[model samples]
Target chain A: MSQTVELKVDLGERSYPIYIGENLIGDTGAYLNKHGFKTGSPILIVTDETIAPYYLDTVVNSLRSAGYTVVTHIVPAGEQTKSLSMLEAIVTTALTGNLDRNSAVIALGGGVIGDLAGFVAATYMRGIRFIQIPTTILAHDSSVGGKVAVNHKLAKNIIGAFHQPDYVLYDVTTLRTLSPREVRSGLAEMVKHGLIWDEAFVDWLEESASKLLNLDLDALKYGIHQGCRIKSVVVAEDERENDLRAILNLGHTIGHALEAVAGYGELLHGEAIAIGMVGASLLAQKLGYSSDIYTRTKALLQKFELPVSLPKHYDVDAIMEAMSHDKKFKEGKMVFVIPTAIGKVEINRNVPAEWVRETVEQLKGEA
Target chain B: MSQTVELKVDLGERSYPIYIGENLIGDTGAYLNKHGFKTGSPILIVTDETIAPYYLDTVVNSLRSAGYTVVTHIVPAGEQTKSLSMLEAIVTTALTGNLDRNSAVIALGGGVIGDLAGFVAATYMRGIRFIQIPTTILAHDSSVGGKVAVNHKLAKNIIGAFHQPDYVLYDVTTLRTLSPREVRSGLAEMVKHGLIWDEAFVDWLEESASKLLNLDLDALKYGIHQGCRIKSVVVAEDERENDLRAILNLGHTIGHALEAVAGYGELLHGEAIAIGMVGASLLAQKLGYSSDIYTRTKALLQKFELPVSLPKHYDVDAIMEAMSHDKKFKEGKMVFVIPTAIGKVEINRNVPAEWVRETVEQLKGEA
Candidate 1:
């Protein structure tokens, strides 16, 4: 059974939906077929090794049942594999699959597949329609947004485009396949969303930390819904994160640095995000914006077994050096997403390196 | 005297204008200063080697005057530089330059620079703001649409994202420094817009081809404006190119395959398009679209010294192979954009490999 979640991105005609439920990918072909998708047109299923083994069969079976010509391309999983090589292989796969301009691409798995596959759709034949069937919880953030990209060796999400999926079917039932670590990782963005825009939501998250950690289905649904809602609203107001969107990066400044410092795959994005949130909280304390929330935030994250400190082997100086290259650094000053208070954050474009250094040092000791 | 052209992307609020003028690199300081741009901000000027000698200094000096901390990363000149390696180099340069999120990147050359630089912006730190100061006629097309990306060694424009610039400044005076071949190169897109969307504009170009060749300022302005207007309409209707945007690739299917077949940098982008239009026209005729128009197109391209025939040494099968790897090929079939008539076009996704090969052979042998 599939449940549909309607999201209006507010971009007039560019607006789309998020169809959430179980057995959705199987029905995706039928849905499109009903929507006038031509018969015998090839359906390209793009996935990463990580998720293909788990869901690729189910999805392909669904397509087969729908009377569509289906083909699949599986690439090595991990951020490192998101490259021109993968793109070319997928294009080759898409070509051999006999896809045409009107043929659909189904992106399976999480952000990596969504991005890699979306990019292929954006450029293939100039542009092709793609559907996102995200498997990871973290994809709640990536999937709702049309920002599809691959990581260049030096930068994450470097090679990409804003190619919106014709439809995004987030089968929540897929969450059963995710490890707790993945769930924890997805929480980071949720927490960041709360810190940046919704204090009440942050309070709700803090109050419901245990339920979330337990993967309470209802709480999980609420979490995904709220996360998508917040993201959808921001996207509606600022479809492209040109201005107001910067607010969404409350914990990303330090989060990205921690990811880079620890290496791409070492730290689960949520663990780094946990540290980033802590770092953000410390920045808030330093700037006198309610240091108390830092403790509460860390406590809740710690409850979830997410990292509350820097990775022990990571070097602070190296992290700060990585910080310098962050997208948030403005005018050569590392901008901190310091909380003004719970549910309130400001882009602290003025936090000195000394503050980052001191906070990083303390976090290292904590680690 | 930098001339300014407004790129009306139609997103409202997120909407900003692109300034195309003479000495934009010099006048750019005031704009940066007025925008509250601070000092010591890392400024990555993404440029190709060809335009570096003629213009990099001016861009650097202008930003420096605005108190921006600045740096330059140069890629080999020409279309081929829009590659994964180039993307990595830009990221590495930014990492080495210590650019922060607050930093800005100035794309200081033509289409290649704008696309690569914008991709750098989209990915570096997960995105940094970039401004475009396009120096070639080709940029009128590349700069306006939010499409930023690079080509794979095996595919053309295969890896990329839709990263729009904060502003784009097109200095027609920049054309003063461009080679005549470069100027002619941009005419291809202008001609493309005319064929796909603006029939009167195509008629205008047909009559003004001589003046355009002579670099008449009025002719240049009209060409740029007309080309952009068609793009503006299309992008506005489909910012993500989901539907109407495909029309913009009027001759690019064959054009891109040619570029990839001959090697990425072998043919200037516009020159390939000139040939592609000739080839697409023949494809159009074979499908009973327009023989007279195809003949006229071949003659016009011949007059401009653009290659109407396929490259002398490249095999037709090899070209077809390259086309097969084209990102547009889906489900084991090739999709071709052929004109219905001189001023009209239709996309045929059902085209077979045999037809593409036969057409290539026929065109390769044509006078």
Candidate 2:
């Protein structure tokens, strides 16, 4: 708490701050009060089963001590929890809890919980305030953008809204409990922030990869702070993802397809995006869009120990079909955020389908 | 089309027009294209079985003729149609039909259809464009306000969003197909538009009640246009119901409770609202907030042949319990939109529970 790093996502009245700190969750009540969460208003804390055993009691006690009525809805942990059925179940819990318009919902987990709870806040009573407590590094990307959603069976994040949070409270101490795979998974998105926007940050992440992996609090804090800052800048400018924000989906094109093709269970989201980023770099190089983009992007992702190739078991045609179903897919064109440099990308709207198909094959390490 | 009357809901960039006329559904394609719905974009038409048999083909043919791809999802016609299950099912259709971010959804029915489809559009891809092809007279009120939602089992419209439509196409010809009860149910809202904001409109409605009941096209169009114009003005002033727009809920607090108590089958929305309005006026008189509000309101509702009294079978405690679950309920306070005059209301944040209970009993015509 003594060395908190804060960034603001400015969207006029909907603007909010993101606090990256240590042990902030213990002071959740104070933060909620300082951020204008109405006194005595009810709150719903939505977390995953995995996180509940660790932090739910602390959050509930903090909120209760603040004289606010608190309710908890714990969901099963995983990507599958981000579904319409879960949304309905949580909404029912909200109703039974008597959450009113003045009430707030706190998302107390990773990307999946943040998105699900944010959407509940977004649609409950036509919109209520919500706060994000991102426990995973991957949420450093999802939490800042206000892009809350659930995945349909056919597509990932196909049903969602751009409902900004009141603010985001990131307590890095929660990261200590994550499995090695989860830590690597979150690092992929942290790396993505640099890949899409800041060359120097990407260079720093590469240098500090081992320190971050070993959970050096200082390095982890600095890395998460930098990642969040980049994401907030992009979100503040393009909250709705109209034009400029599309750049944030740099690797999502093939990344989402890979996830869908693998049934969303084989790879974590950040891992999928890491592969997608590698694939995009390959395509960029093939099209002469950049110099050494494939080698450089792959190297950074590899440093983070993230996957850089699609599993050989994935079918190319299935991946293509999945890409076609993506929310970003428009008018029968393969829309890719192609990197022109280490930290610069261009929206390529008409990438040849065959090029993408070949890139899929290449990603299988066959080429 | 020549007699079409147009008015705009001034919401800046989200602003849209309301067209009141005859046979607008047959020209929905032209309207969609004219309103910037892309020429080649796919569209999903969401309507109930009742309206589907009547005008779905016309909408489908109209869009197809204009070189726009079209898909349709039809649900059973009733208040029950607005639910999370149905929302998910329609989202599935949108996905399977390949409706993209560029595509649009057309809601072709009454308030139920408008709200359901608008929510689908609002959430599909975080929101795509949608048009309101309102086929029932009751929609004159619901279609104008950007309040789109589905009901949870415990409350009416508890889960929803304020996603405005691209435009609303109100074709009076469709009103001819409505049964007598349905016509009266719609007129209840039309009369309410007057009760909440315009004294002269109330007077005019009183004089033209017979014509509106007969489905006289000219009277219907004029009534709808005025109703929409008044609603649009309120919505523009308070798009999110934070302040002035709350006046629009004059009877909805009690009305929504009735709908929930009655299982959404015993009363059409407008009918429930009509009884609720009478009760509101009665409470206002008792509170000394207004003069002659009760008699005049009951007279106007009776002129439209809408129910002014709650049925005798309803449990008072049950209705009271249901009201507590309303999105509008707060801090154990009974929030009611109380009439101050024949054409104006104010948000009453704290009405006595005992008085509300008495008023509910009085509304049963037992006093």
Candidate 3:
């Protein structure tokens, strides 16, 4: 049986909806029209080489069947694709395709495609419209938040923007193709949603772990809906990360640093974040913010086969240096999202650098 | 004796003041601090080769003297400096200088530097703060509207964003170094301000032409202030160019096409716009929208020693083709800002393309 779930991100005029369903890719044109995208203006579909073979044609054909003038830009699949060079390439394609101010760019892959295409939409002639079509589990989080960016050679997401999409079309049917490693990596963010603000979600996600891993459609739909609902609420309150939005960066501070130090190819984004969340819990325990947060977080991640410890070879100094380059780093202070309980976090702006150094060292010895 | 005039652009929180005065470059640090820019976070001063010899050091030394950390990025002075390659280079300088979210970028040259550096500030970490230090007469128009962009190989301002600056510091003293051609070129936009929204200013500009040409401080200050005030009002109502802001593009439609067809190097931006305004008036008269606009506009531009007609050598077909690629081009119709009267214009989306081709042809024979 096919089913669909919908949630809205309430941002006044910038607000948009997130649609989670089975086989939604084939109906993208209808969704776009429902959201007021004009068929007379052109649409650019930005996807990756890996995903193009499966879903690109379907999306293009659907849009074309519905009378949209469509252009496709296929980029190589990887984190490296999120570069300024790639952005310029996409912009060239957009220009060649004659995409005007009324045009919209559709991101038809996972987080990388979403970020890259969203950014292209954000800056092309001072921003047009953007749509996100998530083909990976990780995108459930990236697609909804409107935090689009491309990596800088010196740091991650160093050049980017807060461009909200018209809506996100999350077809979980596409997630069936993800490799086992990709699946595990994607679940890290799902667990993050639970850890940040919803204790009940964490408990439910734990109970439904096997069902989610098995690709049970009902479980997947419910889990994604909850994750997006939580995210949309947080984003609605802090669209620009002015204040409450920092909570969403709970594990990203350490996760982004780890990704930067590891050259972006060593670990999947979610795997890095899984380890970062555990490290945060350990730091929480060290600070007496929580007594058993470290143990509980480690166990939950272990069940999902997510990495909860850093490798011994990665340098602590490199990790620290990368964190300082982060957008969250302020005035030489080490800012961190510290877990206080199973479903609560606090942004600590003055976390001692030496303490973080000790926590990075401790992560390697754990498990 | 030196004089100063301050004007505010009212976009609520995005609102900032424009300061028109003599020797403001030497006081750049005080103004930045007054605007609430932090002294602790590093600042990137982006300038160009032509202006670097005169004002860069004064600006840098003052900032340093005020206990500020400053990094300088200087590029070749030309329209070409507003390219993605140049933007990437400046981003590298910003990264190497360790500019974080709290940091601000100071555009210390003319329109080219302001557009390029403002774009860097717009996207670097998804937009930080930006300050415009306009060094040319033309920047009075470009610096106020928050329309920052870089050109593409195929078109002008094909990539851009509406990121307003924290404030504008216009030091008329810098205008003294401009060559006669440069001075006249800069005044085209000053004339545009009068033609679009203030007829009294046009009569005043015609009367004070020699004073402005001679770099008389009082005349220059008043002219720049009026230009900025009119632009700020238009932008405040439609910050994103949705409706009323199209008035700012009065001459830009043909002006951009002329610049694009001329390969960007042959004609100064304001000179191209001066000729475009003449073409616009010619088109208005052809459309029966106005009668004396053509003669009056051509005479005023001639009085300022600005170009009032397109060069005969340039291909008319090429200009028409370039117009189709412009940001202002929509659908198959010719969208132009047509002057219905000396102090007003209307956005006509259904202007015949053949009529525009005819107007472009007519511009070559005028005067």
Candidate 4:
């Protein structure tokens, strides 16, 4: 039996736990039962085509062995799958499968599957219980926050709700099969977790960058655990980004803009955020925060092979227009999560457009 | 100023108030501001084309005069608009208009607009604030409960969530413009509220049936006020329809099936529910609850000119098939809100399919 690290997210009645371990998907029945998922109730496992063949059977068989009826919905892989058309299809599938309020939806892949399935659960039959079985490292950040949505043509995640899952089953074993780019994409958010909230976590992540990249079991477990822990605390305090929770958007403002301008799926979410974080840091420095902190952050990102500058030939105007479409924009003003120092950030809603343009131009030159 | 009756639906953090009156739409600035809506925040007013021509400007101007920036999204009139495609369009419009987390969505039409717009608010940016400005009498029932949804091809309102509004602004003045069939349709739910909760209210409604149909201001105000008050109490006790709230579905089990079988819009929601309520009473009597209750309930429905029997040409098998798609079906068992007596009902999860079939056959003869 592999060692499992369990942590609880305190969200009053909506609270659930996160279990991080190797090969946990093979025996998820115990965790399912502990979370009040009763035997005989139908469970719909929502996974992508890419992930379905890998671990879907293990989860289905485990639940079936426990006397629960399980159904599977295989969505196409990629960001395009997170659209209203896909949402309608998933809802139709759930309804056709006869899932009721007692029935549960299991999101069994990475952030895209978790988000698409989670939104289905949030609105199907006006809400039902759902569990998250995240397969990628980036999901460690997304699965915990309970912010599930489908993307719109105008903006990404523009249509969604805050529906917390019953529990998150994180099997670190799945990370071993990821491509290097996928691993790097996931590491950007893990790096972000340390950059925004904990100085010690940042120092530890920097020290273990090599081992972490190599998929060291201990390093993998600690990275996901710490990322989820920070997210859980922030979500607990501010379930709906009313105040402090916006800190979690440390790099997402410009990150989402980059994804939109470059066309979604052209850049993996974390890759875009990796560049956005560097832009934000530079913006912070330009705003008279700290140049020293920006240099340190840039160095760490480089060590992990994450992008720290905008892509060459990308239009700054298009990115700025995309940022204006972000939900964070209030009454025509752009809001950015700027770091003043390592392990600390501020939501600067009054950042001028000229400063963003300058940073994008400078970052383009650097790239 | 016309008299206004204010009632609160208590669900702790999700609690909101319902204001019933005439001409409230003309001066909604005070209500919007009172409900925590700040000046200068963008507001999306979602209304159907039918209602938009009548009441959209009143609302848009009212909010604008109060220092708020308002945008409008007009959906086509009818039940078909309660769909995922329409939800996507409205969300795209909100995004295009740059509505944010702090911005609010105001549903300014009847039940369809309220449900569609409410679901949009429920999921937009993971839940933003929305106000309900119900323009139809049918909305008196749909608005008070936090049940918002879009219809699935498999079933009506199968895709939705329990997203409460900041406040429900019910202007009875809008009801005066409704057609005779629309007035009758709205009255059915009001009558159901009485039948399920208060015997005295039922008697009062029976006495005021003529005035209600004629659109008397006093009767309209009282009917909506009492109906909302009952719904508010039930929702407060069971926000998610776990146990107690299921009782509010009095006639909906078979009612929804009747609508689905007949094809949506071929039968108005209240018309279908009115027939379902009578059928439910008959089922209760057949199960040895009380035959006298069925007779008395039939008299009240007939007095309001509401349908009390299934259509002559409807198929029993098709109705049963539709019932199977209902959300109340639990683990292969169909659940019905059976009336034991006036002002009393029970959520009977064990009702046999044979009883439903037999009642449908019998009701067809009566029709």
Best by DockQ: 4
lDDT of 1: 0.76
Q: Give the alpha carbon lDDT tens digit for every residue of B84-182 in model 1.
A: 667777778887887877788888888778878887787675567888888878888987778887776544565566667777776676787777787
- Per-residue C-alpha lDDT of model 3 across residues A1-367, encoded as one tens digit per residue: 5867888899998988888999999998899888888887899999999999999989998999988999999999988899988988888898889798899999999999999999999999899999999988888889887889898776678788989999889898999999988888888899999999999999998898888888888888998998888888898998888888888887888898898789546899889999899888977977788667888888989989898889889999899888776755556557788999999999888777777889889989988
TM-score: which candidate is best? Answer: 3
Question: What's the C-alpha lDDT at position A213 in model 1?
Answer: 70
Per-candidate clashes, comma-separated: 35, 0, 0, 2
How does residue A361 of candidate 2 score in lDDT?
A: 93
Report the Cα lDDT for candidate 4. 0.86
Clashing pairs in 4: A126-B160, A160-B123
Off by over 4 Å in 3: A261-265, A312-333, B263-265, B324-333
TM-score of 4: 0.93
lDDT of 1 by residue, A1-367 (tens): 3345655555567777776665566677677776577766798999887788888888888778778888899888877777866877888787667687678888898888888888888777557888888887899888876888777665667656677787778777778878878888888788777777788888788888788877776676777778888888878788666677677777677777877767546888777778888888887888787767787777767766788877578887788888876655556567666778777777667887788888888787664
lDDT of 2 by residue, B308-362 (tens): 8888999999999988756445565678899989998988888887788889998
TM-scores of all models? 0.73, 0.94, 0.95, 0.93
Docking class of 3: medium
iRMSD (1 decimal) for each model? 3.8, 0.9, 1.0, 1.0
lDDT of 3 at B75: 98
Better of 1 and 4 by lDDT: 4
Superposition TM-score, candidate 3 onto the true structure:
0.95
Q: Model 4: residues >4 Å from true position, as ranges?
A: A263-267, A287-290, A310-334, A349-353, A364-367, B263-266, B310-312, B324-334, B349-352, B364-367
Model 4 error, position B96 (Å): 2.5
